[model samples]
Target chain A: MCNTCGCNITPGNREFAYKPVNGKTAVSVLENLLARNDDQAEHNRQHFDKHRLLTVNLMSSPGAGKTALLEATIDALRDKYRIGVIEGDLETENDAVRIRARGVPAYQITTGSACHLDAHMVHDALHKFPLEGLDILFIENVGNLVCPASFDLGQHKNVTLLSVTEGDDKPAKYPVMFRAADIVLLTKSDLLPVLDDFDPERAELSLRNLGSRAPVIRLSARKSLNLGDWLDWLIGELVQKRGKLASDVLVQPVAEPQSISSNTGMQG
Target chain B: MHEFSVCQALIAQVEQIAISHGALKVQSVKLRIGPLSGMELPLLEHAYPFASAGTLAEGSILEIERAPLKVKCEACGLDSKVKPNLLTCRMCGSCKTRVVSGEELMLMSVELITT
Candidate 1:
């Protein structure tokens, strides 16, 4: 049998053996598998721009207090910001139900057996939402770090959460997620005193090493401690994004970069 | 696990490639997963069969090539492979670095079997 593709073997068939004809002829076509996802993400970006809504994609591992933090955040910003949430999960509508109970528009996207929320799922959920009055949209990505980082949800900002119990080395262990995030939130800080190896300083250093200069905020959702800072930061970001969008339409035409050199500049 | 999602995407890509190649089925999928990509090989392998069932890659084997994390350090100005945890420059111990390569998750090629 061929090891590369698991082709079946035949007796006295040297052609299908180690030197199979056309076996080495396999061409090297380098393509990013996330290309399709990226295309959909671009569409989602245009859609968000059309509606002038600020979107935030929240990511974290399971038990990282994503839902709890959102609950607290919604309560803090509900009076000021017209917030909407799209919750992604594998099985349950539990997070959506909790968010909706808080009197905000929340939709649940059950991916069936899938582990991440792609741009298509969020695009589908957009129809169910009233985009006219909403100022901010929160997409609670499926509880995973790896696959979700490969996908972009057309959000104005991507926020990654890590609980104190999950260890401070998460940024070191998962650099992709940390590098892609616009902000990193450390949740469940109340448990820090009870836990032994919960080093906030070391975690901050690790986050810095991951090439993320995003402001890292520590808060305990359960105790609602230091949550004001998180809420303030989110509101500030939303305001800044909204202001930029409005100014982009009114003040300046789209600026195209002129190539001064042969090399194309990297896109942020 | 998130590997199941990646497997799902892989299956879709393989099916598309097989159809375009006018093949009956995909024989194998060649993937390049980077070291800093944070993908667990064992979980991805375990989820492959489950995700590929009823698709064009129903019986296709997934072959993965692991790429090391290549970085350029600001202090040392040397490009080298570094461990995932210790991203600092090996020579100067400086943490200022930029990733030049090895953060890719790509499907390089697909082997299709024709009748």
Candidate 2:
């Protein structure tokens, strides 16, 4: 039994407690529940920044061609830039295998029962995955539009894919997911001629209605159609990231004892 | 749902606060959930008991305060409350608006029993 709390809770089993309280005083703990995850995400971002890796998180519904887009992207930019992938799925190594077959280094994070891939999982994946000599690292998030948006996977940019078959009203229904996207991709455009029910205009309109001004690009990874625009976007982001990195290097200060002292104070 | 996962995080936070404050147990936890927080209140409520089962917050009550979805219009510069699905500016009806609030999922306070 614990004397202070009047509970039989060990530190190990303290996480599981069932008891009513007799109070004397109350303390206000104003905190963000997502602080832990956010902190981990910031740490991951620092890692990416150190390696100068332009990280992109791909979010979308299942079968929205997140894997297919990665394949196409790797094929198009492999010669110009070294690419890596961190694939997140609920089960199986299917997506990672596909990316590996393209001759690029890939890591698979099989989140057994978790609906979304949190930053802790990504941090763990970074241990097994090599970050050296890679210009771009794409994190293909679990194929869920809702939960994935709530998580920050330490990505520099968020690319959300909305296939034409998923209906035009999806943005209206899944506003949070769409709103978080830095860029929205309208995938499976090859079927657009056959499907008159799904309006690309309506989809963009709905996304706009959600106050998301992210530019939308229509492309079909399978058909290899209009993939250049997507490639250009990737290159543009990479160039901008490299430019920032170069400036950061130029602005790097000399080792100072005072700076170290200030950093020690910040540790608290 | 992810609510269970979120509730677990919330419970863990509450427990930490209780221990740090040298509290015997937690009486209640207050939360400020915004419209754009991506959490369903009913689902979160359902998952709370299971998440808080064996912790200091086991029998604690959850007092949730709902926040309105707010948007700032760039064109009109009006800060107004708007609906989740439709994020258009309420004043100038401009689509060029920015979300100023309603994406929060914060643990406002924890009422602890220190006796």
Candidate 3:
């Protein structure tokens, strides 16, 4: 029987195509819906790799202290590494301006109605903001826990911030975001003394329940409490990336220049 | 909602496939979505028609298959299907389990018209 219309024809019957009512054919096209986005992410990754930039994507809800963390991190690492920031917001350049005030190169992407920062948007931002000579590029994604976790913006690491004000159940509530995180930052730790409802151990437990082994660090960017752990994590990632690149340069000395040039010169 | 954007992407991919295969219109689209895929199925279903309007997949049926969250236990060396909230191994009940399969949002196949 016809699936669409009540006719005496079954599916995969090519003979029925000649009939008036059964003209449809089923094509087995197995494809990924996120292929377009993932392709763009890979392209962005190549660009970052060519410049030897360690890119980290920060995701959180609004007022999660992502900007404040970036400000403190920039201040701490400015003397050591060249840092740049890509701030994503709905309608303002407020976050970008804050980063720039600290004497760092910052580019803001106002997503308009979009809730998350996609790879395509990040790719466009890369064109406007040069990635050269930057040790670290922080992509402070839109303050959304749900959407940002789904889209890959070609970042080497995903850092999720859960403010103490938001309760410890956030990790359990937003398991997808927590699972995607390489490291979870329990931000605004200074208020822990006053707030008796939130527990750091419970938050880490919820994250671990999601089958994620990502380490959780408690820090107050404003108070600079236990901020060294966050800084150490960033430095460790940078050192690991440099080690990988150094080994690549040694193993494929001839292939390194060709690949890097092709990636860098492709757009030009 | 981001579901609308995700639906738009899905419709665009389906339309492109239909056009590539010289299809007259899309009859049905099959998808395999997992619990951990970070997409609300109801919202995606609600946004489908609007996103697919005036496109090849306008009147297409969306056949969504829900996949089980599967994990592989490192300690037990066994793979088992588990709940989304608790991703531990079912047989061994180990916390050191790795996600083998679950977080997938794949377009499995499409049914289209030729004439």
Candidate 4:
């Protein structure tokens, strides 16, 4: 019988309570959860490597001009880089249609009310696309600045876009997303001169205050101002990352650091 | 927003624990939610009932304990609790502090009643 809870448990219950147990079991289970995602991410990474693909995850709020930037990016880089896109949304295939109009292969993943896209979803999407002969792959995460920051979509880089219309305090307000980002893109730069709230210097200061040293690129997709620099930077980064991966694969063994680090260490 | 999805995951965790313990009913669930976890408490609580329905934790009460965000100061070399939105060091006014803890979202304990 148990005396603490006053439960009618014979000697069997006592044995169950005090038996030698492995404490590491709980830690192992917790590790397994993160490890499972990392395993899927590594598989996706290898897929990217085999094809020499550069994957970028784009995160931003709804109506923050993510699709507009994609349209402009596809228009600019499609001729130079063999670009592909995986668009995530709650219920629309609108963004995919836009990307496909630019003559690049695009896939739409409707999360069906899920806020974020996990690595498993990206892995499945990779099978749908012809991975051979692709230079760059863009993943437009569901229009969310918070939840998407927590998920790993097997991307080489994560970029957070904040528009001039959304004000400059976004980096300060949502530090997690900014902290996790490899690049901070200030979209709709043309509106900075018109809007009273749009202060580029203040925005940069706030972004710096959030401890993100990621290069903050200012460009207006609508006006095509300073977009050349943005496209050039992206193309250069994609080429550099692909080259590094190929060289690493040629040198390192199969068991090298498999997990993708969320921090890309790219500072502006 | 994502609180509903998190609630679903929490319910799934509780159900697995209940089944392993041979528990027919769940009494309570304790969770440690950090201040910097970006989870809204009221929204999570509102979504919990819908998520827990028809599961072992159908009538279980979810007790949440808030953990303060802890940051490691680069200048002072001290660990201090700071506000969620503020990224400044508590001991020294250095803005170069790194986060060490208080981003936890875990199921700490569960109470189950067996038949």
Question: Can you give the DockQ of every candidate in the order shown?
Answer: 0.36, 0.46, 0.49, 0.34
Write down the DockQ of candidate 4: 0.34
Report the C-alpha displacement of residue A79, candidate 2, in angstroms: 0.6
Q: Estimate the TM-score of every prediction.
A: 0.78, 0.90, 0.91, 0.80
**What CAPRI grade goes to candidate 3?**
acceptable
- Per-residue alpha-carbon lDDT of model 2 for A92-167, expressed as tens digits? 9988999999999999999998899999999999999999889899999999989998888789999999999999
lDDT of 4 by residue, B1-115 (tens): 7788778867876777566556777778877777667678899999999999999889888888787788887778888777665666777767677878767776766667764
Model 4, A43-99: lDDT tens digits are 888777666678889999998888889898888776777888999998988889988
Local lDDT at A223 for model 2? 97
Report backbone clashes per prediction.
0, 3, 0, 0
User: Reference contacts recovered by each candidate, as fractions?
Assistant: 0.43, 0.71, 0.70, 0.11
lDDT per residue as tens, model 3, A127-241: 9999877899999999998999999999999999999999798877888898999999999999999989999999888888887889899999999999999999999998898
Docking class of 1: acceptable
lDDT, candidate 3, B38-94, per-residue tens: 999999999999999999999889999987889999989999888877887789777
Each candidate: RMSD: 8.6, 6.6, 5.9, 7.6
Error of 4 at A227 (Å): 2.4
